[model samples]
Target: MKTFLNKVLVAYFAMTAGLILLNEPGYAYLWAGQGGTDVYIVHSGKDKEEKSALKKALGGDFKVKFYNVDLLALADYSGKQKAIIKLEKARIVIFIKDAPHELLEGSTLNTKVIIFNSGKDALKSKVKTFYLVDKTIAPPGGNTVRASSGSELNKAEAIRNADAVVVDGALDIYKAAALVVAALL
Candidate 1:
């Protein structure tokens, strides 16, 4: 028992040290040009379908966590503090609709945005980067809707012309998640 405990401690130390080094601020992300800042994705994970969808879109390692973001609190924040807090605590803030875009911007904050239509026009905001989900790309010989992963945006110059890009058999869940991330930008 003593020997086993000692081995566990050694393994824990090594893992912790390796992570600290790999996640250093200056290091770039393993994929994309994202910097090495810690990332925690917030999503509803509505069901097995969405969970599976996200995994297919981003990857198995991208974690999904549940969080409660109260944008109304911004009504009382009276300054740039609230938006900064939201940005700092989560990698991406996910809300279905009715999110108060006005409250999110502050005079002091340099604001940028990525908006998605998703057939919901009220979601459109005046932000800089917007992703209008105008088309639904289904799998071959299928009528279902799915979100394609960012892999398409990486190489598909004609993405704007095509309706949507479907993976193996359906829309990638993470592809929707990526869309959310894109809109939040």
Candidate 2:
């Protein structure tokens, strides 16, 4: 009975340790680049699929470093402050969803901003260049692998021709980000 109890206890501890390791890692990520420029991506939180898509688009380009941070905690004062500090270091800043208004209150003359599915409030940001994702490259009805845009303004050629590139419903964030990044390259 004693030996059986000991074995059971050991198993319990092992299971607990395994569970801890299985937990997902933090959202903060820094992908090193060889180039002098840095690209900062601020989003709500981690999305495995989106990250994978972005990585596929990177194609070993060591020139641009990718820094991703989650603003899910932005309601807290500390979280907001931390995000501002991080944003200040970026040469290119991409804001997905509703980024805090405070982010645009400072000097953005040298920074390039890419906005996706954001509201008119984002227009207030003063950046060197602004790129918006009007729609995704994916086709409608969720039945095809091909990419298409609902509006003429959102097409790949349009994105390339406009002031900058821009997304909307049915478009995966990862795919959209990949498209914009690819266009920039």
User: What is the lDDT of every predicted structure here?
Assistant: 0.40, 0.48
Which candidate tops TM-score? Answer: 2
Q: Count of backbone clashes for each model?
A: 6, 8
What tens digits encode model 2's per-residue C-alpha lDDT throughout 87-168? 6466666655454333443334345565544533433335434445345322112112222343433455544444543345
| TM-score per candidate, chains pooled | 0.35, 0.45
**Candidate 1 residue lDDT tens string, 102-180:** 3343322123322222332232223322332424422222122234444544533343333333433344434654644
Model 1 global lDDT (CA atoms, 0 to 1): 0.40
Return the lDDT, model 2, position 101.
34
> lDDT score of model 2?
0.48
Candidate 1 residue pairs in backbone clash: 53-173, 53-174, 54-173, 54-174, 114-183, 146-171
Compared to the true structure, candidate 1 yields what TM-score? 0.35
